[model samples]
Target: DEEGQPVAAHIPGLPEGAAITEGEVNIDLIPTHKLIWDFRIGDLRKLGWIIQCDRKSAEWVRDRYGEEAYKKLSGKFGGTRTDGETEFEVNILDSLNSVLYEGVGDKQRVVTPTMRSNDDVQLDADKMIDYYEYWHKPTKSNPTGTFGIMLADQIMEYTPYPIDSYPHGELPYIPANPISVQGSTMGGVVRISQARPIQREINRLNSQIDENCDVMGNAIIMVQRGAKVRHSTLDNGAGNLLEYDGKGEFRP
Candidate 1:
């Protein structure tokens, strides 16, 4: 039922659907308890200690050591220490505050580079799906498809064809006749024209490449800007050249 749907009456020790009443019922008296623990650690050192304590039993060490000693201990627990640990603290706090205050009321949320990359990959996926539909147009039920060969061409634009080498690997090409054998269930017949295994693989690989590029590029940009790795994920929200926004949701 939807949020505003009328409440139904439930009888105790009676069979299901025996007596049902339909109308709005007050549910304000429903017992609800929410438990929220304040786990906000403001300082970087404190944050690191919280993370360390969460993973291992280090209460004794934490209690015995001072702030500086605890930070050293925390570093020892990890395999490596960050060089710009001091600057990282300031950046992380600023980033945290920015995220918390984002998209409040009239304020517009600025997309991060990392977010842009994710959107690009999603757009690529959607385009591939469109291409698949185009290739496999005109099924028994629909009889006519909206998509055409143009979509296939667009998909190829993003997917680079590998150059042939001395030890030549099989050269890949988009199938001219992608769909065949309709209404036949016995054999592995393509339901749609563009539903070929090779095409699907190509689309998958293209998506992976786009995602990797976005992530790697965003990470480099974040490091260059002297932001902490913790806040680097925010880079995804940066502006993207590609106009792909997956389902129109700005995900990080």
Candidate 2:
């Protein structure tokens, strides 16, 4: 010992003038408890120190270290994702506008959303089932189908040749063709006879047929089902979208 301080006399390859001295870290004795390193929970868990801390350790860390420091320390033990690729974040002390709030409401409710992607999210036609009657019009490049089931509540991420406009609310082309093995199952085609006056012709008829229900007045129902071409001249002067169902009942 040199003046009650130990010294290394013969270190291998010691420099000629370099003196052996204690570093600032060497001045203090080794710590009894392991050091809780900053921003590293993986290291602490390896040594098995953490147990149930019911705000006891948190209060100690927060009161002395301040809110920012507490947040960092809390994150270290917040746990990891199921995929093990990301760390899960949580806030027990929920606050908004610096006001601490603990009540649970709609924000905490679990929400399930219907998913739809544009033609971009390619769905396999071979994998499609028959229950919902999904169809994707076959194209040369996409040889299979492109359509999927879309409920009223759901909207697609991208419209795949969709006929719906944002404002018009009519998606005329939904990358799908509603079809079955039997074509035009509802009814057969018909052509008006030219033997009558132009006004009395079925295809070119144009007149009002309105009366009270008590009289049961006759009504000429214009039907549009299947691939009926909507020609500018073939309108027959009828209502735009309002049509009749398979049973000839007026449908909105």
Best by TM-score: 1
Clashing pairs in 2: 136-146, 136-147, 163-172, 163-173, 164-170, 164-171
Q: Estimate each model's TM-score.
A: 0.13, 0.13
Model 1 worst lDDT run, 10 consecutive residues = 28-37
Query: 28-93, model 1: which lDDT tens digit per residue?
Result: 211001111125733222111111001122333345344554444433342112221123343234
Q: What is the C-alpha lDDT of each candidate?
A: 0.30, 0.30
lDDT of each residue in 1-252, candidate 2, tens digit only: 212221223254656556444455322221111112234533322221211111123454446547775454443332211111111112211112234334477244223332232433432221111111122222334333233432112211222322121111111121222323355432211112112355465444322332232245333445555436463344333325344455656564
lDDT for 129 in candidate 2 is: 13
